[model samples]
Target: MQKIFLVLLFFIASSAVFAFQSIESDPIAALLRTKLELENPTEKLEVSGRVLESDVLVHRFYADRDFEEVWSRNGILLELAYEMRFEIRQAKFDGLVPEDYHLALIDAYFQTFEANKAAKKPNEAGELVALELLLTDAFFKLAEDLELGKVDPAKLNGDWEIARKTSRTSYLDLLNEAIAKGEVRQNLESLYPKFTIYKKGREVLRVMDERAKADTLDWKAVKLDKAIKVGESHAAIPVLRERLNYWGYAKSQSVLDPKLYDSTMFLGVKEFQLRNGMEPDGVIGKNTAIGLNASPALLMEKAAVNLERLRWLPDTVQNLELILVNIANYQLDYVDKLDTLFSARVIVGKLYHESPIFTAQMSYIVFSPYWNIPPSIARKEIIPAVRRNPSYLSQKNMDVVTFSGKQVDPASINWSAKSFPYMIRQKPGGSNSLGLVKFMFPNNHNVYIHDTPSRSLFSREDRALSHGCIRLENPALFAQTLLKADPSWTAEKIDQAMHQNKEQIVSLPRKIPVVLLYLTFWADSKGQAHFRQDIYDRDAEVLAALKQ
Candidate 1:
């Protein structure tokens, strides 16, 4: 009896699978069934030499329509095809490849369809059906890629949390609704990121593209052996002025000598340095020369890669009052309502120990926080220093503690042992690793923003000097900004708490989101293009995947 029931269930499922592909009195439906059932469906479904990328979506789309032609009625293509084809061609402006959506094949088929209509010939076998399937698949692909990003950031270990713009609408239903209302273009446009940065980047790319097409990209190069200080004379000064002018920075030609770095040129050079993430000193140094010599092609490539990164972010990042730290820029910004409330320099992790890109919420602030040295650091750095200096622990105000965190005598342990089992924690004081306060947003990586005793590191232009944590330049001011809503936690009270020499936790009234990103290229609100070196060397990998 059991065997008979199992056989009945299997037959029911088999009949359900075959229900959609049954050939009725329709040539388009029959052709679609034949092509989709071929042994190699990918090769069989090829439309004018372009194999379909979304075969599964095509199957579902047609099955829902009972395999009827979507782009045509009575073997004549509809006006929606024209609008969709135009959108496919314009996909290039969104940092996407137009040809990836079968643009060339669609063009070929479209021209032949028009020619056939003019000559009074009938639609060719499977021609309209192919267009129907391709159009639907293209629409779905664009919607998904724009809404959820084309690249899988998780595959690259990028902790990107992308949320859909229309969480309540299904893609299939959205596509159907769009076609029914003739709102195809509006539907596609709504999926792109709504950030102002994204819009500015698109405009920048448009200008760059037009320049490339016209072959009119004005760029210049500079070569110098040593730093050219203000009022110095060098043959490359004229080239430097031209380079600055190319990016909207104008420096008047020196009346005395065109090669002279005059006062006017010095200010322009300082502006260039500031824009390119360098110290704004009026010196034509090596790094500034690299920036001056950057070609249009390099900027375009970096812009494309950073645009892809922007697609991976959640749109709400711009909608909230948040703390944003761009690792590549070595800076932190406290922003609300799309305006930066405060900005400060930051020290991030070194190249060997890269600061990860992730998001968490700041829930509390710890005044006079103890520095819990990580196990890796203890094994690699502290133990070696202790081995070299007998009183290293005492000098640094650190203690040898058990896993449970009870203090132990440092001198009682064997200094030369390779397999040490202990944790090193610094006491809360002026010389503590964490200076006076630490903002908490507890994550598995043990990373947080805090004040550091090594305050001099903040003055350096390249502040990637921490051990997988972010060190703030002004923690006191940051605290004041965060606790401004509560009048009790004034600047003086916050200061006294920092120097109390006791660990005290202050819970925030509400959790504010903090996002750490690594965008190497972006445009400021004033339309100035800012560029930074790929400090962690992540551009090549992301760009390769993006183009692929």
Candidate 2:
């Protein structure tokens, strides 16, 4: 009986000690310690509309600091917290929704704390702790999203092979340094992509956002039902002229016919076409009409989508010397540190066989390359033509070759068979399918940039005529530019090799990087945003994933 009474007395004394410690404990730290223990995970870690992107890091952060509250001291909010709030509100200019980082909740908590402080209510402590957690959460989340991205590229597109930013230090370290140095906003801004185009895009987005907030309508596009040309009357001309004038295109007065598509409108149309990556033919066709109908909302979406895509690339891409191909625009640019050395027209793959987006290294230039026909092209095209015309092989200068690459006589083989056991090889010559030269880049897709015998296709604005390879407009000039750095391969030597009618390979001294992409929205060096058609229907997928 005495032992039982002593155990009860010890339990009572322990409960009293625990209650005393709880009364003196830090509520914010205590709440964080308790909440971090529970697990509630989904596809994204979110709670009450607040996206905790770095939930694991948030946990580790508090643990590393021994669950000490950084945003407040003795229930008084720190100035750093307000600075963080200002940055969060400014994120709208960065194409990010501030509410996702607990902006609304934090504002409400601040208001409640003010009311409680004025009324001398005890619940002010709870509001203070809530505000503290939210500010810490917001800082951590912004850091993660700025350094990396909100959505994973691979999750949206399977062929997204662009490398993400690499860093030696963890985000927790960045957070610690940011708080210790009292530079939360600067730390977040420092993670933005340093590319010139990205900066331009951000500025454009900010202006658009400001206009949206101000309820100021810049201009509304007018869609035409039929193709309109100069010297023709159209009902949509008045609004179209007004829109063009708003965009800084010159205007000319012609009181004779306000409804007519006049020369003044023609020049404005050409300028619009040139800026939007159109053919600038001064004819309002189906594509031009689509460009004209780019509502402010759609333009904003384009800006946001392209910005997200740019974030996937390494920011150092702005400084690197490389060959960039915009498949959507059907253009290739050889740029050195964001300056275009030269640009050329290119014909990429058709809609059915879209040119893949990836990066590789151009290793060598093959002058007068022999066409090793893929089995699909041979079976579908060459065999059918050969069976119809007995002299097809001779006309194309192609030889039926055995498995060992030895030429075999076509006369000895049976032509009526469904399957052809031998491969067809086109000899290197002027009439060769691969005109003059081909740039080689080893990849799993077996795609490369090459010159084409069908040069007339390059003149077409929509140059998605090739099977899968990229066909350059002038291969000889491209070769000269690529080999200009090497003392052994001069312009004269490159010209000689291209027309020599003999296959020769020249390995580059160092491999140059090649990036093939399909950005429909890009900003020029002059700070004008350019938009193009989504030829591959890829933007919708990315935009949808972004909203998610």
Candidate 3:
């Protein structure tokens, strides 16, 4: 009975596609015209919430065609419907839940249509209309999610004001174009970022979900009272080996020296450490233990959340020179045409002063840049420090200036005043907060990538010690790379400009796009996934929103 039903669905589905290809007089338009003229418009669509507005779009679309069935005509689904169904089933490849796009409802309608055909009974006219309406709704819903991510950026984080503007293309017109070109799947797929990392994330999530269901994954914390060094003997060595093997870090079992931390186990632990955003020291420490203990499901959830964040990026990222800064990873990648030219370590903002996730165009580079103290820092730190020590400004290569650019004597100002409304500008020198050079991308955040005198911080595994700005380890090298398009700015010229004690601005020949994103989980080109600590704890909020 099951085999018969399956064969029946395939036969009807195939017939629908064949009929669509054979029709020359726009069968959908004729059916829609006949349905619209009927006294009863009984197929009231079942859509609510944000999607309710699509009803007007759907009605206008059919009315424009004189009430023709778009996806089907006379109870026969079209090739467009089959293509849409296939795309909907593969929505996970785009970091979307298939269920969210009404896949089950669509399958149910097709199954019912198949049963009616097999029984030699006509499906209710209202039911046929409902099928078309729901399928149309699914297309729009899927398109919306693909174009603009599931959550609004502004709602999630007010500082995330860098999302691309909504496309002005009418959903109905897009559907019509897709149907005409027989490219429903292509249309939907074109709306997302063309990065392979997203596909890897989906694949990882699938494996994680399977592991979760089988209960084969273990996240039990492995704690040793004493640190285990290479070639050291420990009671927990066997358990550590088991855990490492389960996570695919270790390939072979060592029974001869099972209780000893040998070279093989040491290398596996280092690789695991690297994947977890920790310094790969090969010594099992507290942080390594914590990383080993992270639940696979939790890591999978992070990957899923980050995949959605990728969807929030502007579509321009597909074909542009992109400077992507992964805040969680504390690394920046200079990419053009999907090829990563180089990567550098970076220092992001501290937890209390979180770095924002946004996109902007890098227009220019400022050499020997002055750091204008932010009002909050001036009020909280500079003023307090100056009050305690009268020579604080001169000692730190800083000067007091009025809002109107008039220089003021730091010693002359009243230190005990309640309000300090003056600007504290740091001089362009080695001790300046902005180091020797800064990459300027004008935005409301007042944040830019710059060099730092505190170069020692870059060596640390966790380099999140900034005042809401990124500090590049090699700012001069980055500046030279950015000016590669300009023949005037040679490597020697860039170095000379950086060493100068005077401020100078050099605009780029073409603006480079920069994206500051906080992705806790990232997959490299080779499909090796890495998970970072949610320094800002954004994963939980994003996961909660996805649930809603």
Candidate 4:
């Protein structure tokens, strides 16, 4: 009888201890249970008006926590709230606006709670659960923008097929994973671009912003009727010197004789011209004037726009052998592991025929290639030319060919037709439009990097003259570089093939990836910002989207 009484006493004492422990250690759990019914998570989310992209994810998220507080526990999640606040504030560095994510409201709510943690009423704390839901919603929205970009390039430009992350974890899952691993910063950083270029651009922005704060450059347009070249003095020299100093091109602003366009000033002007995508001839012409007139704020806006454009690129560019074309800059760079193996000035499509931005695998290099003139070009250009002169095709080394490889007499076909059912192919020769070699990357756009007979056009500062194809400055050099993998094709052999005066197809042993991109503003490895003309007027559209 005494043993049974002792066992009952011990059971009662154990139960009391367990209850006290639950009440003391988990006050938030006890309070939430009394204040809110978490089992009906659908209704809870409905009341908050927070709908996730995936309903299943929402249901699973709430089910995991039984609709309990995932973000906050005692008053508010002070540490996490502060972390989010910091990220929001740092959004500008990433070319993002914090106001877009309700940054002010989140920070205000967190601050109020942090200051008065003990003053939170039970009902008020329960009501603040909505803050938890709102924050989670905001966080996921932020992540999506940072990871996948806010604007869809495909929607803006029809030809842009930028690969995006289709599969991603739920916001709840991401939060839990971060918390479990105790790595908030790492998780947030993962959402941004993996490219080092993006980071370098941010650093440049930071430095430029600091400089702007110290003294905002108030550069006025310095117009001159005549061109200002080296070894010649001009009245605009003082203004030009001031402008160069503001742009960090000139060494000092405290010159006693700023009016003199000395050799030192000439060097600075040349460097400025080069960085601004103009010919570094130490000549202050119309193009150089435009660069000097662009204020620091305008330059920053350009950089920000290009940074957002960078976000549209793939997170992982696994293509080791890359042919990257910067259309805005009118340059092509063959890069491998952050090293530029080969670079050349390229003539891209004109404003009307803007080059389509995309990526593809180059399969082959054709030697002394025949130029198959596009149907649109033939209808718009060839037909008209033939009408004016019947000998146009023969003079230009062009011939009419049926779709099935049958040669058709140019005189036999009516030149007055609105469209031609046949293709016009240029015969392989020095007079042929496709010079000597062409890089073929099979794409629907029918755009190829090829040699051109108009080599003098490459000397122009602005080389946007092609219809839609990329015209390489040195095709033989490009061919030699690409065929280096094949032991059978030597540099001498490549040169011989190009000068063979007959069409010959040479397939690449291994495929090389090619990316045609547009970047009006970017930073070099040294964090120096480079600006280029928006030849196709693409920067304004992206800037408008960024503002939106």
List per-prediction Cα lDDT, in the order shown. Answer: 0.82, 0.79, 0.79, 0.76
User: What residue pairs are clashing in model 3?
Assistant: 32-67, 32-68, 33-67
Model 3 regions more than 4 Å off = 1-44, 47-53, 70-83, 111-122, 177-183, 199-215, 220-240, 254-262, 285-296, 404-406, 485-493
Worst 10 residues of 4 by lDDT: 46-55
Per-residue alpha-carbon lDDT of model 3 for 160-254, expressed as tens digits? 56765476446777888897898997777676656778767777877777776766645666776877899889887787777788788988764
Off by over 4 Å in 1: 1-30, 37-44, 72-77, 111-125, 157-169, 216-224, 235-238, 251-258, 315-318, 337-339, 524-528
Please count the clashing residue pairs in each candidate, in the order shown: 0, 0, 3, 0
Candidate 1: the clashing residue pairs are none
When summed lDDT is taken over every stretch of 10 residues in candidate 1, the lowest stretch is 160-169
| Per-model TM values vs. the true structure | 0.86, 0.88, 0.82, 0.85
After TM-score superposition, the amount by which residue 140's alpha carbon in candidate 2 deviates from its true location, in angstroms, is 2.7
Q: What does candidate 4 score in Cα RMSD to the true structure?
A: 5.7
Q: Quick one: best TM-score, which candidate?
A: 2
TM-score of 4: 0.85
Cα lDDT of candidate 1 equals 0.82
- Model 1 C-alpha lDDT per residue in residues 1-548, reported as the tens digit of each score: 99999999999998866764455567888788776666375353565556676677777776787777667887888888899899887776667777778788788889999999999999886788778778887888877777766777777754434332343336777787777887788888777777778768867777777756754545645667999998889988877787777766664453678888888878888888887899998788888888888777767778878877887788778778999999999999999888888899999989888999888899999998889899899998999999899889899988888999788898899978878788899999999998999999987788999999898888887788988799999999999999999999998999999997679999999999999999998877777677898888888777778678
Q: What ranking emerges by TM-score with the best candidate at the front?
A: 2, 1, 4, 3
